[model samples]
Target: MTSYTLGQKYISPTKPERGVFPLDHEGECKETMLKYMLCLSRNDNKPSLCQAESKDYFQCRMDRNLMKKHEWEDLGYSNEQQRKT
Candidate 1:
């Protein structure tokens, strides 16, 4: 028999088209995601080590108009990385 869950089943989000931003974009920002992949490879494939890279990658996406605008602040972290000076 199958067991029922209280919440919605964990369905993976839709990925961008294969030849789209971050996937087919050019320039240094494109490497952000690559950096994450490298980190993951070195860190026993752990997903956490690549978070920073993922953030950069997403920021790049927004900057390039690949994703919707005005969503960076929400998607970006609390800006704790920013310095007061």
Candidate 2:
């Protein structure tokens, strides 16, 4: 059995690197999220095959303030423009 000391110091947990954001209570990004989910399902859960839908969903989240805005490159969509060319 472990014993607790009366003078034990308390250490708070650190925040996540990405930081927490508000929930999408208005269903603002529901459609985009569903699209991504459907794409994943159709692609046999292969995320690489659903990159477009994944980006769309994240874009929607950023637009609705559900998450912080980040550069496409930071979000791993840097090659998106190249793929379109």
Candidate 3:
């Protein structure tokens, strides 16, 4: 399996490289990817979405794209304002 070593640590999922080297490995699966993306900084030392939820919260929601309500909330827009813009 292809693996990436970030410094001394190994990157999981053994995903395909840019331009599609291979897609056999799936360690960095959709769920892992979403979790990483959603982890975009909340604040300085502030709790992130992962920090606040139940351990299995994301475990169940993994791989699903962020919903409209969440996307709007993240953009600092309400449902009404987001639809208008």
Candidate 4:
């Protein structure tokens, strides 16, 4: 049993704008995630160098229902096609 302060204000925590979702407990995208991480490590921690791996991981999450599905352009991969040209 604890006592409360006379003028203390209590603030309730709130969820983030995107809110929280279930984790990949079954490792549905573990390989893709590992590839992304490995790419980052090999590129001196530069994410720009791992765009493909990142996109693949995100796609895996969407396919496995771990996250909401979105377009590649909407996810900032609009230049992926151009880069391949």
CA RMSD of each candidate after superposition: 10.7, 4.6, 15.2, 3.7
- 62: Cα error in model 3, Å: 12
Candidate 1: 10-residue stretch with minimal lDDT: 76-85
Backbone collisions counted per model: 0, 0, 2, 0
Q: Where is model 3 poorest over a 10-residue stretch in terms of lDDT?
A: 61-70
After superposition, which runs of candidate 1 have C-alpha atoms over 4 Å from their true positions? 1-28, 70-85
Q: Which scores better on TM-score, 1 or 4?
A: 4
Question: How does residue 30 of candidate 4 score in lDDT?
Answer: 97
Q: What would you estimate as the lDDT of candidate 2?
A: 0.83
| Tens digit per residue, CA lDDT, model 2, 4-66 | 888999899876567477778999998998999999999999988888888888889898778
lDDT of each: 0.64, 0.83, 0.40, 0.83
Two-way TM-score contest, 1 vs 2, winner: 2
TM-score per candidate, chains pooled: 0.48, 0.71, 0.19, 0.71
Tell me which of candidates 2 and 3 scores higher on lDDT: 2
